[model samples]
Target: MRQNFILQVILSILIVTMPVSAETTIYRFTKIIDGTGEALLARDIAVESGIIKAVGNNLDRSSNGNLVDMGSLIALPGLIDAHTHITYGLPEAPKGNAWGELGATTREQRVAAAKRNALLTLETGVTSVRDLNAGGGIDFELRDAINAGAVRGPRIFTSGPGIHPANDPSPEGTDKTTPEFLKAAAEKRIESGADWIKIFGTTGSADDLTSRAYYSAAAIKAAADVAKAAGKRITVHSYGIEAVDAAITAGVTSLDHPVGLTENHIKAMKAADIIYVPTIDHNRYYAQHSEEYGYDSNVRANLRVFVGRNIETVRRANHAGVTIAMGSDAVLTGFGENTCELRAFIAAGMSNAEAIKSATLNGAMLLGQDNDLGRIKVGYTADFIAVSGDPLTDINAIISGVTAVMKEGVLVVDHRTGGKVNKPNCGTLY
Candidate 1:
């Protein structure tokens, strides 16, 4: 009897540790875009061990697993939002500040904010994101917690804080910024577990400080050096030509908000292979719907310049053979306007396919997860979303919630008329 009880316990552990079977669960769909910049096709996909094992015209699905038959639906690799603030919606900013002057809150409060947005973003088929700004390394902490199964969220690649030029004007009476202070701040962020370093080369007019002052090239270099020594690349936020030059000299890996990327800047970027994450969505969305976000007349007037300048800048970037990735600084005000960035990219003369790539594969590459997450290929993680109509024919289909989801080998959301479904939990482990 004792021997039999021990045998039963061992069998239970094995059953829990191993997948139920080796057979693949097939998802049959009428249209599939394999995420290789290839044309869409009518095909079936096979998933096993949480990875795509096969995808073709006639994939054999003989074994038993849950069969998801999506008829007339268009499927593609999960969308990736290259830039997002998973926590902290756009709160009303005072006249001088652009919502960046929120009171410093506890890390726990910030983590809660991030988790809420992470789940919402995941449901929108953005299976992954690179969070550009957060109060502290709290965003990174959130990512670690989620990956460790302590919290639920989309795959996160985060830059803990927005490092700024020390000389930039701070809020009233604050001590002036110095290179030494800036370097110390950078090191502190790195030590705090930042995945990537984010440097602000210039003080944008959008900040309370009106002057578009840039960090000295030496100062920018210091921040970049610290990031490199810590084994991470630096992402610089710049909206002026001079600042762009400083970023280039500093060897920044990516430039965000290139509101004035000149022809020379473009050449340098391509030469350095530095990617551009032009946040066209913020400009486009704010121009069209500033009122929705509670922007009064004065704020709206200022935003007009932001929109016009960004449009011209994007046009120049596209003409110069520079690589551009999509970034929607889409906040609470611009929640569903993520796809508007795609439309603006298309409007700026980028080919439809190129714009799509910016949001999908290009984003994955930007986050350095190209091998595992970007395309729908054999052995890649199963992260994909489905829409009601063909995205190629109508890019707006991606914007609408035809079937917003993250298929990480398991259904995260099924808004298909049935009641909400919760994340899976243990049920006796058998």
Candidate 2:
């Protein structure tokens, strides 16, 4: 009896440690735009264990797996938004205070709103984003939940809270005026689980439009140093020539808004190999939704001026061979409309293919996720979107042409059949 009991225990242990076979998914597409600026062609993609297993003209369908026929649709890598605010919302006008909106919501309400925003964003074919700011650790918690499969949303790389200098009279616990203090602030963000460090290198917003450097070069460098030591990247919110120069000199990973950038600034950015994320669509959004956001005529005028100037800067940067990444800087209402920036890039003299690269390959490089998320290669993650028309011919297809969205081999949105394939955790918000 004792020998039989020991044998039974050994068998149970072996069974517990055995690896389960991963489900395989096969997707057949009529055309594939691999996000490498290569020519488009029809192809088949096979995914296993959430990673792409094969890509070829004719894949064998004999294996027992889920088969998805994306008939005649243009398949492209999943879109990426390099800059965004996941937990921010614009309050309704007539009763909304732009500044007061930040403090009005409770933490629970903000998290709920973020979940809704994530669903809306995912439906638009954006499978990844870098959220720059959120208060009270909400962004961190949201990111963890998504990674744990407890929530359905895009992959998130977030900076818990942006660091900035205190107002005059220097509020307590908010002193970022010195290099030492800036370094400490960056370390604190890392300790709080921030994937990247964001610094307010210049003043911005409707209240003030002047692009002046708020932090000296030393301070910016100090923060960059800390981020590098911790194996993280740093992005700076900068505008104008002086602030842009300061950020470049400090070796920042990306510069947010360079509306005031001169030719000299562009040259410096190219020399430093810095990435530029011109949030041109953000300015246009405010200009178009002036009344909705409670902006006055002057604010609208300023935004329009900035939009034109920002586009010109982007053209100059592209011509100079500077890496440009797409970032909408979209707030709450702008979630689903984030792809509008891709259209803006085309209007700024970039070819349709180049604009798509900015949203896909270039974006992945900016987030340091190129190894697994950017291109539709054999070893990369199976994150892709399908549109009805050829995006190469018509850039508008990126905005209104998304028919299906697949992230990690799971179909989240399938507009072809008039409904989503796999229902998201939070139901449709729009």
Candidate 3:
């Protein structure tokens, strides 16, 4: 009887002392669509300590964390918008203020807008974004704010001030200074913690009602050099063929527009290994709904030519073996409709897989964050979104319903009702 009592005490002690396995927040999905080129599979992904711990079948639910049973959902890396001016929208300035107003907006107002835009963008499943320009180094502030947990938003990579010549006319208030001044101004932006440099190398047809010719090759090269010296890349905005050629020759890392690119210019971009991000949505939208955007007829007609020509250009570039990254120049109001851009790419003749790559892995590579951001590999950041149908079959599945969104192992937006699970608490881990 005494021996039996001792055995009972020992058993009770053992039961009390044994450690309960840590809850790892296991997300059991009927489908796991890793961003890598590999095919999707059924598996459970585990997250804990704000990192993805494991991914496989029959994951131990209690050993890891809470279980989110995603029945038959398709998952992929969270979307990245390669080029965006989220903090600000197209200005209503009549004309001639493109460079001036951009520079004149107060730092305080710009910072506030950046914060608001960041939150709104995150709710739509944009886990990351690149802010190409801000009037006076305000983007950096927004980036810091997001990082410091003061805001709920996508990770921000920003360009402090888009370097351009002074007093050059445009309605967007873009900076348009000379090359010498551009280099100086770019350096200033870098000092203010710009992630990249934005350079305006050419004038568009209706850019601030300008019929003026684009900037020279030498001038664009000068700006690129300045950005390179600052240990950053320069992405140039060029609507004219001359500007495209100059940007390529000047070693600009990326070209934003190929509006009037010639055959030679296309070959040049391919040879130089430059990435082109043609914002086809704007052109397509303008083509179909010019009156809605209120653009002039001549400008609208010019856009029509540019849009169709660009579709052919993309096909030609693909045939010519040029690298491409996807970006929608259009502002996203919500998640489900964001896939409109991918459909646009398909309409332009790209395969569905190719379009998906342009959005996921290609975008991460463009930001130079591929190591920790893009794919669904074990070590990468746990940034992913899930939908009901197979995105592989229909790229449009991405926007249908972002059933779930995870960033750094935390569930930010759970689309059961098209609402966020909770406002992201960037400062907390638990």
lDDT of 1 by residue, 1-430 (tens): 9999899677544432333234677677777775555554436667787787666644443345556677677778888888887766533332333244334545565566667767767655677888877765677777888777677677888877677544234557744355565667678778878778887766663323243645567777887888888888788877666578878888887888867676888889989888888886575455455445445667666666666677778788878877778888755434445556777676677876777687788887777778988777767898877677776777666666447464567767666666432221111100
Regions of candidate 3 where Cα sits further than 4 Å from its true position: 1-23, 90-113, 166-179, 205-214, 260-264, 286-293, 296-301, 331-339, 417-430
Sorted on TM-score, best first, the list reads 2, 1, 3
Candidate with the larger TM-score of 2 and 3: 2
Give all TM-scores, in the order shown.
0.81, 0.88, 0.79
Residues 355-420 of candidate 2: C-alpha lDDT, one tens digit per residue: 888989989999999998868877899999988788889876777788898898788787887874
Consecutive 10-residue window with the lowest summed lDDT within model 1: 421-430
lDDT winner between 1 and 3, please give it: 1
Task: Estimate candidate 3's alpha-carbon lDDT, on a 0 to 1 scale.
Answer: 0.65
lDDT of 2 at 384: 92
The per-residue C-alpha lDDT of model 3 at residue 359 equals 75
Candidate 3 lDDT, 49-82, residue by residue in tens: 6566666655663354466777888777787777
Q: Which residue pairs of candidate 1 clash? A: 166-177
Choose 1 or 2, whichever is better by lDDT. 2
Model 1 misplaced regions, further than 4 Å: 1-23, 40-42, 61-66, 90-109, 165-181, 205-211, 287-294, 418-430
